[model samples]
Target: MPEPEDSATLYAELLDSARRLSFDLRDCQTGTDDADRYGMTPEWSPLYGTPTWIRMSEPERRRLTRREVTHFLGVAIWLEIALQIVLLRRNHSADPTRPDVKFLFNECADENLHSLMFVGAIEQLGERHSPLDRVMILMGWVFRTFAWEEVAYGIVLAGEEVFDVMQRDWSIDDRVAPAVRRSSHVHVVEESRHMSFARQKMRDRLRGVSRVRRYVSAVLIAFGAHIIAKGLINKGVYRGLGLDWQVARTEIGRNEHHRMMFRRATAPLVEFLDREGLLNGLARSIYRKSNLL
Candidate 1:
């Protein structure tokens, strides 16, 4: 692919975005004594509107929400670790004088802080790991080592964009816990810049790339997105709430409301990827199975 047109200008814009959007992690504090409350709206809950949800007592639902939110935060940490590794690998040899390199380093710093925040949130809510966590970590290692530049960045972009949608929602809803809302607000504000950078990077890397690579990237990105979406709500969450794990998972999968939420959250990303020729037939099928199409 050809070099970024006027890299200096692109660098300047990214640097300015980083500067203007940075947030201090220390500012994410809750004044309420019951700060460990549920982190999102009941409507945003995974099993919301399901028959199981209707049958669940209020306390059961609230406990599930808290645990599910913690699992989601754990997912954030998982994604951030992969993202930081790929980003650092991508730009490690970049010219320090370039604005893009500086911006990338800044992003790594932001992600580091974000990871710490997520860990704190998870600890506060009680950490719960998915059964797939170990496998996902191995996948992250493979991705950082072998995935094509555009594909790696595309994967990163997919996670950030999808999570940004949820965080944007959580940040504004008054029903969410204050500390959780603050974290979501910070993430939405900072990830907007990361998303911009990742999109442009994907565009640059895709320029003049071979068709086979594009097709492979499309499938891989979709597959990665599938894992992410499924792993967001762990079975442990249901077990913790005294529900049958398989039944809860099945109900969540079949829940039209929950499926619609995924579709809506991923719509912008789907549009952008399709416009860029990264959402091919195979990718669309994969997204459909994940309820993101």
Candidate 2:
């Protein structure tokens, strides 16, 4: 709760927290899925009954739909991670006098690795038009708004928190084939710990900041993440198929049938922090700032 006059503790905390956060993701020791696999588990996903009327074959549409949804969202995830490194790099590149170069270097390396995986996923989805690419390009810029110091870190933390649960839920309860399980397993493995680290990092960051700023930023990050998720769902996908925008946005932004599906999307961090005995601060209050409460 001291004012964060020096970024040194933050540097150590960020690294330590990132490492700890990465642990569950790296190891995935205790994972699970929703109990129901009748394809209606979440009951709270914002993306329930998405526009499924494309002309492609069902299997092809399934793969493509999942791929498009995953690839773009993953870009937000990877690029957000990338920008964190970029922020450090921008700071360090010009000021050789900056002492935190070592930490920045570590951040850059991790972001690069994460970015590569995300890029590979994007490439795996074949290709898209210039406009879709433009949407993604613009999204990267929007994600930058969150990365402006603690806000960016918070958003990533929230996102990693979301990623851990959704992937875990999908992986656990479903009796999918082994090959597909890796898809769920790989993500759950890395993101779960990433969420943990983000939680601690936020906890540590709040040690010295104001409650107002803390509360504001936490809601901002959560709302921003929600907005980004909403945008990623897109009106065109649904409206183009003759679905109402209200119905579409509600489904992607606030529906019941897929709630549990995306519940993990918001659950891990809450559970993690609750278990850590680290929740009574500004960040804790921030957790309750949104409808997620």
Candidate 3:
């Protein structure tokens, strides 16, 4: 744990960094001739190395990967929009003069730009926005409306960290579409600052909190993580690929390779949550069910 003064200093420094970056959505290059390439790394695909995956033709595999990337980008756009709402609500009640509050506004702006970037990528891929199911829509509404402090920041960090891990790969992988790579690179660069701010906020909010409150917050955060992890890939993706949706879902459920990838992506977040005492028994169980443990 960092001292309060040190945390404050680090937060200020992060604010300075955010100001210096000032990334604009317009700078992202989405006009690339990458229609025939994969939109995500093949190994990262949910069905990678499975019998179903092995049976896929090269064109089919490329189509699946492209739809999967569209699903990911759509989910990111939804999460960003929800997070912008949460940040705006927090800023509305916070002291505007505080550096942290200023960072919140900066974060909201970044999220807005990120959403645009995602939308642009999806458009470039010739895909429309993928909407979440009603259940996830309701869960997102509850979370963005009522979640606060550690819980809010925890959820924010979980979403950003998981995406950051995957995007780090997408941004540099030569096999992925150029537009997807470019948008992912932009997201990764700007989200680093947001993740730092989220960590600082979570630590600050958790300090001196009671055990019972921490326990409850742990469950809530874990539940939020579960929702986020599950929401990334939509069922419509299989339908879009002209496959049986039920079979695809079952295969995805049994995919140890995808599970391993998910666990690896979430390792840093799990470690940080454990260190912060937010990985209680119930939280651990939820994370396990979500394949995020």
Q: What's the CA RMSD for each of the models?
A: 2.2, 7.9, 2.2
**Residue 237: error of model 2 in Å?**
4.6
TM-score of 3: 0.95
**Clash number for candidate 2:** 24
Q: Which stretches of candidate 3 lie over 4 Å from their true place?
A: 1-4, 27-33
Error of 3 at 54 (Å): 1.1
State the lDDT of candidate 3 residue by residue for 7-115, as single tens digits. 7687688788987876676655555346679989898998898788999988788878888888888878877887778778866766776777777777887888888
State the lDDT of candidate 1 residue by residue for 40-112, as single tens digits: 7677788998989898877677677777787788778878888777767767777776677777888888988
Worst 10 residues of 2 by lDDT: 32-41
Output candidate 2 Cα RMSD.
7.9
- Full-model lDDT, candidate 2: 0.48
Tell me how far the alpha carbon of residue 282 in candidate 3 is from the true structure, in angstroms, after superposition: 0.8
TM-score of every prediction relative to native = 0.92, 0.59, 0.95
RMSD of 3: 2.2
Ranking by lDDT: 3, 1, 2
Q: Show where candidate 2 strays beyond 4 Å.
A: 1-57, 60-64, 70-74, 89-104, 127-148, 169-187, 236-247, 250-254, 271-293
